[model samples]
Target: MDKNIKVGMADYKVASGEEVLITLGLGSCVGVIIYDSSKKIAGMAHIMLPSSLEIKNNSNKMKFADTCIDLMMDELLKLKVSKTSLKAKIAGGAQMFSVSLNTESLNIGKRNVIAVKEKLKSLNIPIIAEDVLGNHGRTIKFDCNNQQLNIKSIGKGEHII
Candidate 1:
């Protein structure tokens, strides 16, 4: 049987073979998935912020896009997964709140999405698919067996990306 590894908010988890990585309640947060298909290795990070530099006492590295991805890559590299073999998939980053003023600072979700993309690009990881930016929260399951990310949202049903 395959093990299901649950990743929480501001957290991350890595798995291999038949294991599946899952995360829930992704409102304004983003679920960043990175995997090496040939090795059947995968990881998921539920990032709550765009950058760690934006806040004081940001000790939780997993909560930000930049730090979280760097840490996850280190783990993957340790597992003998080459950076060249890595691919990515992302979900969540929803605009959950309705604000009267249309300002970039208020759109944390969009900021997160952009940051994730920038970080991935810096590391030369290609995002194969993504489901992001809506007014709803998301729950995601990353299956290591086939490198597929299954995303579920309220009133949006379920789909694999």
Candidate 2:
């Protein structure tokens, strides 16, 4: 374990060695995690919004769905993870904004899921699984050792990681 390594919100963390990175409190936010078990490399991102098209003068473009994937992909590549060997798993994207909208078009959670799907498709990275879209919040953890994903909510039961 690396004492210098830490986890936080609205951020993506990766571990190449034995270190494991995690994040939590994902409400209306999406957690996109990519892992390569062969290389013991894992990355997790907590995205708050669907697209950055709304963030005027956006300097932190990596915080958006489109760029976050790209950013994490680049980091993985830098770590020598093959694109074909990499797989994605996502969670959260809850409709917890408290504003009602048509689930088809106006829901930011759906939009985030759609954008993530499209971007991953464009990148040729297949998403293996996901637990997304709901009115409740979620907390996700990714295990680099086994490439397992864990998800928990306020009232839901704990899942494997």
Candidate 3:
């Protein structure tokens, strides 16, 4: 039987075989999914910021897009998953605040999505699916056995990608 492993905000988890990785409350944060189909390994990161470099003395590396991706890749490689076989799926990155004046800092959701995409591109990891950009929170479920990402939102029902 598959078990659900919860990944908290500003956190991540890696699982293989029958385990499923999940994360909740991804508002203005992104849930990044990296999976190796043949190895049946999956990883999920719920990132809160675009760059770790922008923040001084950052304690949690999992909270930033750049660092989170890097850390997740390290974990996946530790599991003996090939870098070339890695594929990505992204969710969340919502505009949770009503910004009267658009600013770079205020557009955190958009910034996170862009940063994640850029990081994946830099690593040569292809993004297979994405569910992003809106004014709502999200709960993500990643099934390692099937390599499917399911996204849930209030009033939006659920979607699989």
Candidate 4:
């Protein structure tokens, strides 16, 4: 049986083998899934913002793409998963509201996606798949056993990456 782990908004979770990780209601937020097929280790992060530097809160590292990915990498390393073997699948980062059309700060989804990609590149983690940048929200499920990322949206239905 697969153990389902729920990753909340601005949070992250790690799993191995047949475990499944899920996150929901991603609008301007992004869901990042990392997996090592050989080790059967997987992690999912729900990032609400692009950078931690922009905010002074200093709380909730998972709320920022840069810090969130770093935290997840540390956990994966602790679990004995090789960094070189890690691959990523990202979803969400949608432009949910029309008011965010041209505004930089309000267009958080685009910023989140850019920051995520930059962070992943810096960490040498290749993003193998992604479903991003639209006008709707998303919910995602990451299967550790097969490294399959299942993405679902209200009007978009479902897609596997």
Candidate 5:
């Protein structure tokens, strides 16, 4: 919802039409959320890592992008939300790397973005919109009722889709 809502690291929230979910400070992490207007369904996640393989014991599912998205989808299904009609949007992934000026393009943020896209592709989920890659952070808000996404860079305008 909109009243001082807060989603900490590796956290997600779901609600219906009456609520608005938002998250900020997405750099190498991704905000993968889905909205289904007809079903009045919505879900959001903040994925801090790129894959589950890094965790050999199936630990901390929310930390990995793939597992995080799956977690969101799994919960949405429990609400009777069908994946066939689900629409996904992703944001965040900046060159948060300080490796070297020559490696500015090798930020983990870009890797995270690519990982999310690959995961979605494997799941047959289409990305309706995205605002990824750069040397900055991102803030995202999803209005579930209307399936609208509001994306904003730190000092730029909020983009609506």
Candidate 6:
């Protein structure tokens, strides 16, 4: 039987075999899924911020994209998963509210997405697919067995990436 592992906001989880990683309520937050398909190993991070460097109270490493991905990579490496074989699939980072200001600082969703991509590139993990930058929140689940990311959004329905 497959176990459903929940990755909460500002948190991360790693799994292998038949385990599935899931995260919910990703509004202005990004759900990053990194996996080694050959080993059936996967990690999911629900990142609330782009970088931990910009925040003073940055104790939680999983709260930021840069730190979270690094930590997840370390975990995967310990599991005998090679960095070269890792691939990523991301969802969420939605612009949930309308903002009159055109300032980039207010667009946390876009910033989160950008930070995630940058971190993944720095690690040489190519992103296989992504569903990001929209006005709807998302709930995501990553299946380790088949290496599929299932994304669900309100009124937007659900789809696999």
Return the TM-score for each candidate structure.
Answer: 0.97, 0.88, 0.96, 0.96, 0.87, 0.97
Candidate 1 C-alpha lDDT tens digits along 81-142: 97798999999999998999968899999999999999999999999999989899999999
Backbone clash count for every predicted candidate, in the order shown: 0, 0, 0, 0, 0, 0
**What's the residue-level lDDT of 82 in candidate 1?**
76
CA error at residue 157 for candidate 5, angstroms: 2.6
Q: Of 3 and 5, which scores higher on lDDT?
A: 3
Q: Lowest summed-lDDT stretch of 10 residues in model 3? A: 97-106
Question: Clashing pairs in model 1?
Answer: none
Whichever of 1 and 5 has more lDDT, that candidate is: 1
Question: In angstroms, how far off is 110's CA in candidate 3?
Answer: 0.5
- Residue 67, model 4: lDDT of 96
Over the stretch 1-161, how does candidate 6's per-residue lDDT look in tens digits?
64999999999999998999999999999999999999999999999999999999999998999898999888889999977899999998888999999899999999999999999999889999999999999999999999999999999999999
Q: Roughly what TM-score does model 5 have, to 2 decimal places?
A: 0.87
Q: After superposition, how far is residue 39 of candidate 6 from its true place, in Å?
A: 0.4
lDDT of 5 at 65: 83
Looking at model 4, which ten-residue stretch has the lowest summed lDDT? Answer: 97-106
Candidate 5: tens digits of C-alpha lDDT, residues 45-125:
888878788668668888888788888888888999877888788888777657755663356687788888898888877
lDDT of 4: 0.93
Model 5 segments more than 4 A misplaced: 1-5, 55-58, 101-106
* Model 2, residue pairs in steric clash: none
Clashing pairs in 5: none
Candidates' lDDT values, in order? 0.94, 0.77, 0.92, 0.93, 0.79, 0.94
Candidate 3 residues 29-95, lDDT tens each?
9999998999999899999999989999678999899998899889899999988999999998899
